[model samples]
Target: MPSLLAVCAVHALRPDSGSVGVTAIDKRPLDGEVRVGPLGVRADVQASRKHHGGPDKAVYAYAQQDAEYWERELGRELAPGWFGENLRVEGIDVNAARIGEVWRIGEKVLLEVTMPRTPCATFARWVGGAAARGWVKRFSEEGRLGAYLRVRRAGEVRAGDAVEIVSSPLDAPTVLEVYRS
Candidate 1:
């Protein structure tokens, strides 16, 4: 059984030079249950709505396994939400999750895997420095970019909740495949 390791949310902010401000992709774990609504996790903000946060991209979930891989590669420990994921999931192969796959969290919140998060300038800037390019290239090539999900049923969610796979459509491209392509 997969489990929710953490739930995170962040505030939107303006970048130093760019006309478009960046949502400081810094997400911190919530202490208790948080509401999941049609748009997304309540109070969560996405600076770039053209590329993120919509009915098809309401929530973002990253697998702990992928984070562990980055930790090994970067030679640093990464906590949940380090990659700006709304939910840090453990014991699940997020790369293999298919588009349209449905997952139930806790009792009522339901989410459907929709797509893979595309790397953006905001992400690069958030990472900062010369290492950003390398990180982007490697992440793109590796295809472990994590899955974007749409809210199927609005409810409360929190860490330690069980993640139940309600449906996984056949013939749908996996999240990793979508990322790689």
Candidate 2:
């Protein structure tokens, strides 16, 4: 069954770490129940509101499988939340989830699939060095980008919770489809 692997929140804002000269992208796994609000995780913060943190992009979820692929390519480990995702999931392809898909996480917290995460200069800067070279272009080409979600129902969430894909609109575009376009 599809399940949550990790629940994370921003550890702190690094004032000198991103394209905008600040970022909350370096997340850390959180223990116990983490509150999910309309804007995002209770303990999380986005440094650049112009590019992140809104009703339509409240929570980011990435596939553990996708992270594994990166680990192999980068020759290093990618711990959960490494991609700045609030949730790291397994047993489901986040990129394949249809837009407008509704997911029931645990017994609470409903999240509607919104869009694919777009790689940006902030991401490239966060990566740095050899991996950062042509990163935006390479990431765009790979199409392993994760899904952004809108919080439909807020609740406390924890790792090990089941993720049920409850519904989706008919003929809705997949995350990958949106990313490729």
Candidate 3:
């Protein structure tokens, strides 16, 4: 069964985040349950409304498998939420999730896969150091960052929650298809 590994949200801001100036990309995993709404995890800050945060981009999720891949490539261990993902999951291919596919997280909160996260200059700067060099280009080529989701039903969420796929639309594009296009 697919499970939510962690629930991450902005704990602070980085001032020199390239184009964005300030960013909430450096999120930290939270303890206990958290309330989630149409806008996303309550109190999670999105520095740029134009680039992020809204009904469609309410929650961002990255698969632990993908993060592990990066861990090996970057030759470093990564903490939960390091990728700015509200939810880190395992046993599900988030990149292959189809657009409009709905998921029931835990006993509540129905969310729909909306799109894939687009890497920006802010993300590159947030990475910093040798990894930051051509980071965006390499990330784009990899194209398995994560998926953005819209809340279909507001509810509470926490780590260790079961993630159930409730619906998948054959007509819709997969998250990876949308990302690479």
Candidate 4:
């Protein structure tokens, strides 16, 4: 049955760090919904043309392996262990999620899947990976990693919360399809 998964920490830029304690948000399925939650909460950070905060800008649960090259390229180490995703889902398959899908965290907070995450140069440098570009490209091709989402509702979220899918778009598109087009 559909149930809430582990609410992961939300971080920006740095993979070995954490930010915004988002826990216990409510996520339920719904119909005829476009903007699932709210804005600013899941909205992208415009700092230096980069997106931060919110679920959309959140990193995936385990997409850092591809960034293995960074360890060598940058001569540094990455942290956060294995749980790479900002949110660790138990039931819902993040990769299978479609664009415009909304997830409720706790009672007031909400998040909607917008588009698949596309890595930037900063991420490559962090991991010290040389072929960072190729790693990102392969990730898109495999569709193993999930997509970026925007915040529909702004609130606090934490772990051990139910992630109820409130809405999902019809004719759901794959991350690759969405990214390619």
Candidate 5:
């Protein structure tokens, strides 16, 4: 079985306060069973619906200086940075997933790679990294970044849910491949 990444849920900024909208009605957890729609969930609070804004709409994983990378790059113990991915999956590299591929979550949920996640100005402050702006630019060049997907089918998803790639488009582009070209 092949896997494609999907954000089970996300925390959005409240319209007024600087606080995160974690428990809003539109953001509440579903009861572990639902159907995927064309535009995804019509409601604002569900996981799939939130990603309508592209990358900013969902996650922001980063590959900064980590203990693993540092050991290879500089040979020292380094703190790893977490990208706030809803599912911290290992084994499969989400960044390398190709576009127009259909990723199924658990059993019911499905996502289609519609585009690459383009970093926005909001990320500069979101990350607080001094070189975040430059980092995003370099990531674009390396083509090792993830993508933005639209919900082809919406359903309840959990953190440890297994994602599977059900379809791969022919001559399609990976997120980075699309970005680079």
Candidate 6:
């Protein structure tokens, strides 16, 4: 019953820090269907491939519920893709999603939950400067890190598409548990 609230991607950018970056972390909602390939959403780029973007971590999804919680805590409006998620979804417990879970988006694109997103220094830098360290600490302590997914079937995905869980392995750990460990 969960649905895709947004699909987002971003182009490369050069930060003021004089470093070459492709931190597509600042994504914006796409208006129409976007291709979902084995690498990830079409045109989405990762600044640091050493830590992100691979066959096992192609796509990232965040639950709207968790965003709402952060909005309240940060006392600021958190929009879709605010946390650099490729997919903003609703009506699903992303924190409870286990590894090996398969999600069929719309009628085509299929994705499998692979792991939880671990907070990184790049993320902290993207969020804030001096306070970034504390932000990462708080975020880790919250244990609400979103899920990373790998594409199982390539197809087009769009906002409002239904997300159906086709399978979830019983032996796998939930996203929160993975974050804690």
Tens digits of per-residue lDDT for model 4, 136-164: 55445656555566776667655455678
Estimate the Cα RMSD of every predicted model relative to the unseen true structure. 1.5, 1.1, 1.0, 9.4, 6.9, 1.8
TM-score of each: 0.93, 0.97, 0.97, 0.56, 0.59, 0.93
Candidate 1 per-residue lDDT, tens place, 12-39, comes to: 4546344455574777788799999998
Task: Sort all candidates by TM-score, best to worst.
Answer: 3, 2, 1, 6, 5, 4
Q: Across residues 1-181, which tens digit of lDDT does each residue of candidate 2 receive?
A: 9999989989887766555778888998999988999998898888888878899999999999999999999899999888999999999999999999999998999999999999898888777789999999998899999999999999989999999999988799999998888
In candidate 3 the C-alpha lDDT for residue 83 amounts to 91
Worst 10 residues of 3 by lDDT: 13-22
Which segments of candidate 4 are over 4 A away from where they belong? 1-47, 51-85, 129-133
On the 0 to 100 scale, the lDDT of residue 68 in model 1 is 96
Q: Write the candidate numbers in order of decreasing lDDT.
A: 3, 2, 6, 1, 4, 5
Q: Write the per-residue lDDT of candidate 3 for residues 11-95, one digit (tens) a residue.
A: 8987973566788998889999999899998879899999899999999999999999999999998888999889999999999
lDDT of each: 0.86, 0.91, 0.92, 0.49, 0.47, 0.87
- The candidate, 1 or 4, that scores higher on TM-score is 1
Off by over 4 Å in 6: 11-22, 129-133
Clashes of each: 0, 0, 0, 43, 5, 0
Q: Per-residue lDDT tens digits of candidate 5, residues 58-87? A: 322222321144245334432222233333
Task: Report the poorest 10 consecutive residues by lDDT, candidate 5.
Answer: 21-30
lDDT of 3: 0.92
* Candidate 2 residue-wise lDDT at 34: 88
Runs in model 3 deviating more than 4 A are none
Q: What is the lDDT of residue 71 in candidate 6?
A: 81
Q: Which candidate model has the greater TM-score, 1 or 2? A: 2
Clashing pairs in 5: 2-165, 26-45, 27-45, 36-153, 36-154
What 10-residue stretch in candidate 4 is worst by lDDT? 24-33
